[model samples]
Every structure is written in structure tokens, then in C-alpha cells.
Target: MTSPLFGQMMDVPLLASSLLSHAARHFGDTEIVSRRIEGDIHRYTWRDCEKRAKQLSQALIGLGVQPGERIGTLAWNGYRHLECYFGVTGMGAVCHTINPRLFPDQVAFIVNHADDEYVAFDMTFATLVDIIAPQCPNVKGWIALGDETCISTHLADMATPALSYETLIGRCDGDYPWPVLDERSASFLCYTSGTTGNPKGALYTHRSTVLHAFAASLPDAMGCSARDAILPVVPMFHVNAWGIPHAAPLVGAKLVLPGNCLDGKALYELMEAEGVTFSAGVPTVWLGLLNYMKQAGVRFNTLKRTVIGGSACPPAMLRSFEDEYGVEVIHAWGMTEMSPLGTLAKLTWRQQQLTPDEQRHLREKQGHVMFGVDMKVVGDDGQELPWDGTSFGDLHVRGPWVIDRYFRKDDSPLIDGWFPTGDVATIDADGFMHITDRSKDVIKSGGEWISSIDLENVMMSHPQVAEAACIACSHPKWTERPLVVVVLRPGATVTREELLAFYDGKVAKWWKPDDVVFADELPHTATGKLQKLRLRELYREHVLPTVDEKVV
Candidate 1:
């Protein structure tokens, strides 16, 4: 046969232009809405968003934000941050998203370390700025995002050239001519939550991030489309809200943003008013809505689906939404290294015939890999394990969007072609991947596996439990045991016996925590993750369970 390699090599542009361009081209008139603090609805379109992104690029350049220079944003998910995301990356500058949930000191550290020339933030973070601004020495410009009238004036001694959001964009010519960008050029940088150590930057290239957005938009993945109105409850700062904004628009989905108003009433109100069909967030955020539903009805007739990630999703939460509210929670798992999307729990057609209860059981697993993702589980000895689901081992994955290597650090997690996800997982015969725990977070009790997260999930299922954390405390007889630290709902309480009984027949009896302690509130990391390690340290000395307690 004639050499087909001579056929013209397919050439596709690497810039994020694909996502925005597709939306602006076909879905120009589709609505992209944002809910406001004063309970107002703001509506625009893809073309409007594209125009704003271009204008913002011109605005940044006008304000001395030259291409290739780093710009930072400590903001919420809304049209403004969306503009900054594409505009900054499109202009050939690196957009660094600072997790506002990060401690003020860590925020200052990241900004200064990235040598950010400018910072744009939503109105709600004015106080957060007050604490971190003094330390971000390289930030030369501060643009308070929103209408000029809404910006606060309690500025302290922080020295930075200030500009109003509207004024900045208005100063620029609406049309922006972007430079040709290489796929390898750094597009954006998102730091890990640094729960285990100092936060490190994961530099994303135009090629990697663009491909990830496309992968995320796939039907088996987020399954986003223009007809779908998505509310990404996850913060814009966290892995680009798990890449929802980037991918949702590309898939032609209407994005409804709840800016800085993530509480239950705020979220439910936005979801209700916007007619949101899909939403995504960590389990903690949704738990609030569940609580709110009990107090005031949760009418989510329009909301049929939501993606739950950034920690394990309680099976009970999944079953409750499916049973009560008629919503499906897609439990996903991934990390910063994988562009933060590894798996999604959507079932195949063959499994549809399964009973609802059986389906719920399967849906609790992490999920099968998306189209381009390849996965495996290996032992500590670096040997591959069978995907029998019952076999426990460390999980590994490799994909186009997976981290080739850390941005500046040397020790790589990749061996051969795979990147160790640092999560322990098991894959059943049907290919459903179940994450047992983060390799670092696993608890070895009497040489038996005791999933801290599973116990925590079961704990949070209790009506009186607003939130819960289960951590491994050192045990004399068993090298480790689960300690349940709980945050109770206001005006609700359950005795220890009552709470433990909630898990009866639900989980193996041995997996139950030896003791339970109630707390006014659980400690959270900057990214809103329960600080489980801290909880373990706090309760380390309390040896309430005797060796013979198992029999009792």
C-alpha cells in the first residue's frame, strides 16, 4: 500500500481558543448566568463572554501586564474569573489561581513565589487581601473585580497600584489580537492544597490543559452540552473548579455561577433561580444542602445530575439524592497531577438493568477511566495486582493530561509510562474502580484495612451529624484504630450508641470507630478539606477503647 504517512498531518490549534471559539461560534446566543448577593440574576452569552475575555486581555496589556508575565486571581466562580482564565492564558501569560481557602500566609507565599505582577479578586475577599497583600511584594497591580461601586475602601498599608474592574476593561479596545502560542507554553498554574506539606505549583501547559478540557467534556465524563446548565459549586481556584468552567463551555453548556455564596441557602437559591441541571462540589458543600432540604424543601426538579469529587462521596448522600430528590451524584476521583480528573462513576448501558439498590452499590465505586485514561493498581513491591476489586493496592494511571513531571521538583512519580495516583484503589471485574484511601491516609489496624473515609461517610449519614472526620489513632493492641470526630447539626444531637448504631449492617462491624467525640465544628484546610491529620493528633492521647472492647 502507498505510504499513508505522507497524508497531511492533522493540524489543530493548541490554544484554549477551541473551547471559547466553539461556544461563540455556534452557541453565541446561549445564556451564561450569575446569581448576585442581592438576589439578582445577570445573564449574558458565549459571545458576550468571548468579547469580555478579549477586552480583559487588552485591559491587562494596557495596564502593563505583558504576555508571559504571571497574573494571579483570588476570586470565586463567575463570568469575571472565567474571563481572566481564558484572557490571561490566551494573551500568553500564566494565570495563577490562588485558592482563597488557603491560609493568608500561604496565599502570600504563592503570590510572591509566582512573582505575580497583578491580582484580581472578587469583592468578598477584601478582608483576605488585607492580611496577605503586605507580603505579596511582586504584585504591582490590584484590580478589585466587580462594578466600581461595589468595591470596599478599607485598604490598609498594602502597597499596590489599584484599578476598578469596569474601568480597567473600559480602558481597553474591545478587540484583542492574541499572539501565536506554542502548545508547550505554560498556560496556567494551580497549586496543590498542601494539606500534607508546603503547597507546590503544578504548571499546566496549553496542550495539557486544552486536552484535559476536551477529555472532561466527553459524554462519559462530565457529559456537558449547551442544553445543560451547570453550577460548579467547587471554587474556581481548585483545579479550575475541577475543570468544569473550561470544559462546560466547550461542550456548549450554560454555566451558572454562585460567586462566594456557597452556603446551602445561597447555593439552593442559585440552583433554583438559575434552573441549573448539573452541579459539582466536594461532599461537604452538598451535605449542607441536604440539611437545608430537611428544614426547607429542596426542589431540584431541574437539577438531575451533580459531580461529587475532591474527597470521597458518602454512599448515603448518593442514595438519598437518588431516592428523595431524584438527583444523581457522580462520584469522581483525581488529583492535581492528573489535571485533577481521573475517574467518573457513570454506568454503562449493560448495567442499567440492575436494580436501583444494586446500581447505587456500583455507583459508590470511584468509577471507570474516561476514554483516554489508562489505569492500574500495584503493590508496594512495584508489581501489578489483579483488577479483581477485592485485591487492595496502590493505584496508578497514565494519560495525555497526566503530569509528565512536576513543574520544578525533581523526584518524579511516573515510572515507565504511568503516574502513581498516590491513591489506593481496587478495580472489579466489571472495570469499576474503587478508591479505598489515599496511600498516605490508609489506616493499618491489627494489620487489617480500616478505611477512615468510609467510617466518616457513614458517620455523616446520621441526621444529627452536620459533618464528620474519622482519623487513625495509634492503638496498643491494633497498630491503629479509627477515631470519629463529629460536627453536629445545630439543635441536633445523637448519643454515641445511637451514632454507632447508624452503621449497623451498613458496614462491617469491625470497621466502626472505637470511640466518637462531638465537636462544635471540624477543622478544615484552606481548600475546605477536613483536616483529618490534625484531628488524629488532637485525639492521639485518648485511649478510650480497651483491647477487649471488640467483644463488648
Candidate 2:
């Protein structure tokens, strides 16, 4: 038997606090700009953030917060919330970010489920905190993420008197040291949108978070660096702004937090003024920004690249940004379970050499996996499918950042150690993944599957269509057929027949929508995903128009 030899490398635990410490030491002067909820622009540096984070840790420790305790935050993206992110996690306590957009009942349920001791909320969410406070009995107290004036002005009428965030940190000196702990300890906790039942929590460890940050900053990923000014339009309450809050500090990029103001004009002006070189957000957000730019007849001065995730990016939106605005669009896909970053649609050298039209078509798919993630498509029989770009199946992924099980659940959600993504997709031989439809949303007609995403994307490409959703409606003969619900652009008009005919030659005749209905707007989840489940229920009993038997 051969003896195994160990390398003489030092043993060190990967910690989230070290990211902040490194930024503070190496890029102390790097700026962290924010549009505060207080209706003002706030600016600071990594050194200043580190000092305040230390003070916040001291204040949390003084409040009797112990290791592994959950410290909840119901705040927007800003300097104060960023401080809490590092401060709570750095002190060995779990930083639980509660999405304010969730229903009051869901918020309360998450608070109780996580057993959070203290919840620090922005003044913007003061009323929300007041509503949920009575339901979360285990929570010791609520801390307002504001100063004395803010609390007196905003939280004065609340049933529970909240402590001022500034006051708590003000009482402590900035001399606290972060404790060293096992890297596997939980550092952050985030709950799903809970569209069905009670929301479940995905607990993240220090090691996983740090590794995710490193991977996210890679050249082919978000490509964070000290020279870039990055704005995360995604809220801090959502997957820690898709890990920008950590990845930004890790690379010393000038962090720009867009506080409650997510409108097109606000985001566009902020990006122009800050000279943001890179940004990441969902497709719905970019839609607003593109509409604003087109209407305003303006152009970006320094904005270059954007990562569109949270949902699929429409081909039209990608073309508009890349062709018209000269901005590179990196279409990305991920879920909350995998630290929210799995694939990004950046063209490789070989793919880039193709014709521009071919490149555009290829860019529509979710790109190759990040270095840490391993994924495969499996058929109903649990057999792995080939990556031939035609064998659509359930997507399964396993990675260090991916969750093994829900936070307090006993049973595991993994199948053979791979977490099923609930998405129906095709992976090309080149390793690119294209999501055809969510498993629950796929339309089945006459024993054949129709991708609702494909129909919706094609409908959205129409000049007059503002937004579209495809749902499975019952058919008299085909069992279930595709029904499209469309929202038209303002002051634009298009007949249902014309829109339905527009799909000619674009997709298979059988895959074309059987009916089209106009809606003022489509439903979206709290995180901006299409609420197809709700749409399906609303259109479950919808009747399709009688058509020629041969045409059908």
C-alpha cells in the first residue's frame, strides 16, 4: 500500500469577513455609493464600511446576539444594509434577508421560521415591520435602519417602539475583531417567494458564499474589478442582490446600490451620472430602461455590459441593448437554491467567429456553467440525456453553493445528490443550456409538449406587444392547447388574428397558440418572474375559438 502524502500548505478557513477585510486594506479609498431611502445620495469607502461594520458587530454582540443566531434585515440596497450584511455575518451570526415585497403573512412566517432575534429594517419598511411584528413573537426587538430623526418621524406611531440603527452602532467603539469559526457555519438565510405554501429557507455557509463570490468575479462571469462601478438593480433582499453585495467588496469594485428607486428614469440617470460600466438585473427592469432610452432619445456614456437574469432575456431586448445601445448583454440563468448564478450567455471565441445572426441566435440560450457547478438533463425514467440540443428534459444541478436541503426540513430534496431545478431545458453539445419551459407550465396538446416560453417569447417579439404570457387552456379535442395572453404597447393596436398569423414560419404550425387574449398587464412574482401558475388557474376554464378542423 502506498502512503498518501499531504502538501505543506497552511490550513485556513474561507470566511466572508475576509472579503471585506481585504477590500478595506487593499482598496480603502474605493467608493460605495447609494441612493438612500431618505431621498438623498450617500457615499462612503471600504475603510469607512469596515469601521462601521466592526461597530455594528460590537453593537450586535452587546445586544446578546450569539453565534448562529439569525439577524434579520428588511431593508433596501444601501450603505446601512451593506454594513449589516458584513457585520452580522462577520460576527458568526446568520444574516437573514427578508424580502419586503413578500406578503405580510409570509414575512412573519419567515421571521418565525428562522427564529431571528433582531430585525433591522429601513424606514421605508417601518409600516411593514409594524404589521408583521405582532406575528413574530420570538423576535426580541426591531431596529430601524435609520437615525433618531428617522425613527421619530417614521416609526413613532408603531405599536412596537423600534430602536434607531445609528444609535446602536454609535454606542459601540469600532475596535471589535471578527471571530474565527468553521467555514461551514451558516452565514446567510434567504426564503423562496412561497408562491405555493409557506416559504422555505436556503441557509448558506461562509465557505460557500466566499467561493461563490470568487466564481462570480471571474472574467467570464460578472467580471468584477476595482476599475468598474457596478449597480445592482436587484434588491438586497433577493439572494443578497444575487451576490453582488459580497462579490463587489471582494473585488473592490465601486458599489452602487439603487435604493427603493427602480424606475427607468431613475436607474438610467444614476447609471449615467455614476459612469457605471457594468450592471445586473432582470429582463423586466431592462424593459423599462430600454423604453425610457428609446422615448428619451438618449444614449449611455459609460455603461457597457449588463447581466440579465432572474428570468430569461427576450431576444428583442438583447438585440436592442447590443445593436442599438452598443452595450453587451450577458443573458444569465440561475435559481435561489444555487446562490442564484449558474450560467451566463457569454459567447466563446469559436462562437464569436460565427455570423452576427448566428451569434444572436446562440446568445438566446443560457450559456455554459460556472466553474463550480455541474449540471445534466434527465428524462422521466431518470436516465441522463445527451447534450444534442434537442433532447429536452428536467434540469438537475449539484455544486458547492447549491443547497442540499431546506433550512429546518428533515428530508432532503436532492435526487441522487443532484437538485432537480424544475425546469425543462435542452443542453447543446457546446455546453449551452436553453430553458424551453418550466415543467409545470409546459402545454400538452394531443400527447405532445409545447413550450410556453417559446410562445411567449415569439409573441413578445411583435412590435405592438408589450408583454405576453402563455398558459395551458383546456381544449375540446387536444386535451390542452396553448393560449396566449398579451399586453399591447401603449397607443399601439394589433388584432388577434394578425398577431396569431405573425407566428407563421417562426415556429411549427402545431406549436402556434390556439387563441390570443388581450390583457392590460400580466401577473409577475415578487422577484419579477411570470406568474404562470396564477395565469393557468385564471385561464383553466377558458374556451378556445372554433377553427377549421384541418387548420387545427
Candidate 3:
């Protein structure tokens, strides 16, 4: 037997710190603008950010932080949070980003589950930190991401004396060098939204993070470039802001971080003022911005494209951006376990030549797979489905960046080496994937499957409907029926009968919702995805009118 042959090549491992170093060396003058929680704008360059990140690492070392330990962050998308992203991971510590929007008990549960040694949070989370501090006994200390005045006034009464972010880093001269660890060393830890149960952690390594950054910055993915000003409306705590914190620096794109001011007006103003050419966020945030623009009769000056994910992007929202505002809406889909980037709806050159309407329909799909991810649809027997654009099945994916098993869990979540995405979807011959519905949210009525997403999209197209959520409700004849809960536009009037009638020609007769209920708002998860689990619980016993009539 012949021994395996190997080629001579450089063996340098890919690490997250190298990304910042590259940006600082080549794109040192590029700006990273952020809207501060202090009602002011903060500006810095990539070189400055690199220096401060090193200082932060040194400060953490001075405070006795060790490699392989978990350092938690409970802050929004801002400079300090950005520093923590690189510094903590660069020094071989796991950067655990906890979503502050979660319930207090959930937050405490995450901190305890991860065994975070120290928590660094923004001043805005002072009250929340104070409430959860007693519950998280393992946390050695708390660090406020603010100046001395912020700590003295906001966090003075904490159970433990809180350290100030500015003061802590000021003492260090940034002399510490980043450690060169194995490429598989853990770099980031993110927990799911826990809409079903307690949030589970997905641990990411240096190699995976670096590879994810490379794929995320591709021309077909987020399309990041140094010539563009990129704004990530997604919170930093959510899957590393969909990997933009890493991708932006990789491509030297000017970063504009909107810190907790997610309302339409503020976002529009920030984008305009900062010359943001590209942005990414959840559909809910874009809806607010679109509503504001429609009401104010305004238009964007510089924003050219936006990546909409965290939930299904309604067709109406996509039309509003492309047809009305001239902004391209790239519908995306992913989960925390996949490092949050699986596919982006970038049309191929062949598809782009199709008629405008044809192209629009193609763009509505979740999209083609990125280079690093390999996906397929499987049936109940775990057999692969055809790519005929009609056969829908469970979506499974495997990739270097994708999680093999969740943190601290003994069992692997993968079946046959592929992670089930919990999404029911179809793929066309061109390799474009369209998500029909979540497996849990798909409505089955009298043995017929009805896509709640399809029903909601139709209802959302109506002029009066502000938002809609379609869920399964009990039926006497049919096992289940679709019930749509709708929130109307302000000052708009539409009766339940009228709204239900509007769906007449849009869908099949049986596919139409059986009942329409007006609601002030719909429940959303911490990551901005619809909370269908909560809705299912809330209306599990709800009876359709036809069923009620039979009962009467």
C-alpha cells in the first residue's frame, strides 16, 4: 500500500483576530459609525477599533479572565459591544452574547447555563442586570459598557460593584498579544430564542466563524464591499448580527450600528445621515420603516439594498421596497444552529433575464444555498425529495459552520449528519428554495396541508391589514382550520367579513381562513420571528363559527 501524499502549503490557522488586523492594515481610514445610547453619535476608524479591542483584551486579562472561559455580553449593537466581539474571541474566551429582550428568568437561565464568568452590559440594561444578578450567582462581576458617570448613576446600587468599560480599558496600554490557539477553539456562544423551551446554546469555533465571515461577505450573500456603507439593524446579540460584525470588517465596509433606536424614523434618519448603501434586519423592523416612509411620503437617498430575515419576508414588503422605494429586498433564511446564514435570494444571470414578474416570483423564494452550506429536502421516511418546485419536505443542511451538537448537550441533534431546520420547503430545478411553512405552524385541515405563511402573505397584501398571523384552530368536521389574527392599519376600517371576502380570488376556497379576528398586535419572539407556539396555546380551544353553530 502506498502512503498518502501531501502537498506543501502554508498551515496558518484562520482566526477572528486576523479579520480585524486585515481591515486595520488595508482599510484603516474606513469609518465605523454608531448611534450611541447616550443620545449622541460615535465615530471611529478600523485602526482605532483594533487598538481598543486589544486594550479590552488586556483589561480582561488584568481582571483574571482565562482562556476557554465564557465572558457574557448583554449589550446592543454599539462600539463597546463590537469591541467585545473581537477582543473576547481573539483572546480565546467564548464571547457569549445574551439577548436582553428575553424574560428575566430566561436571561438568568442562560447566564447560569453557560457559566459566564463576567457579564458586560450596556447602561440601558442596568435594571435588567440588577434584577437578574441575584439569580446568576456564578457570575464573578459585572461591567457596565459606559463611562464613570454612567456606572455611578445607573449601576451604583448593584449587589456587586460594577466596573466601568471606559475606565477598565483605560488602565491597559494595549500591549497584550492575541493568543494563537487551535482553529477549533470556541469563539462565540449564542442561545436560541427559547420560544418552545429553555434556550439552547450553539457554540462556534474560530475556524467556523472565520469561514462564515468569508461566505457571508461574498458578492451573492450579504454583498459586502469596502465601497459600501453597511448598516446591521439586527441586534448584535442575535447570531452575531447575522455575522455582519465579522463580515463587515472582512470586506472593510463602513459599519453603521443602530443602537436600540429601531423605530422607522430613527432608522431612516440614521441611514440617510450615514450614507448606508446596504443593510440587514428582520422583516418587522423593515415594516416599521416602510410604514413610516409611506405615511411621511419620503424616499431613501442612499440605501440601495437590504437583507430581510429572522422571519419570512411578506411579498407585500418586498414589493414596497423594490417597486415603491427602489431598494432591493434580499429574502434570507437561517437558524442559530447554522451560524444564522444558509441562503440569500440572489437571482442568477439566467433568472435575471426572465420577465419582471417572473423574476419577482423567483426572488420571493428563500434563495440559492451559499458556498459553505449543503442542503436537501427529506420526506417522512428520510428519503430525498425531487427539486421539481412542487414537492415540499423537511429541510436539512450540513456545513462546516453549522452546529453538530448544541453546547453542553450529550446527544447530537443531527440525523444522518444533517441538521433538520424545522422548515418545510420546496426547491425548484434552478436550486432556488421556497419555505412553505414551519413544520410546527403548517395547518392540516381534513387531511389537506395548508401553508399558514401563504395565508398570511395574502392577508398582508390587503390595504387595511397592518400585520397578520395565521394559526391552526379546532374544527368539528375538519381536524383543524386556519384562523387569521390581523392588526389593521391606524385609522383604517375593515370588517371581519370584508377582510375574509378579500381572500376570495387569491387562494383556493378551502385554503382561505375560516375565521378572522382583529387584534391590536401579534406576539413576536425575541429575535423578531412570529411566536406561533404562543399563538397556538392562546387559541388551542378556539371554535370556528361553523363548529359553534353545530354546538348551539
| Candidate with best lDDT | 3
Model 2, residue pairs in steric clash: none
Candidate 3 C-alpha lDDT tens digits along 47-156: 99999999999988888999989999999999889999999988888999999999999999999999999999988888898899999988999999999996787667
Worst window of 10 by summed lDDT in candidate 1 = 152-161
Q: State model 2's lDDT.
A: 0.91
The digit string of per-residue lDDT tens for model 2 on 451-480 reads 998888898899899889999988767878
lDDT of 1 at 465: 81
lDDT of 1: 0.82
User: How high is the lDDT of residue 136 in model 2?
Assistant: 90
Candidate closer to the true structure by lDDT (higher is better), 1 or 2:
2
Q: Return the candidate ranking by lDDT, descending.
A: 3, 2, 1
Q: Which stretches of candidate 2 lie over 4 Å from their true place?
A: 1-3, 547-552
Error of 2 at 460 (Å): 1.0
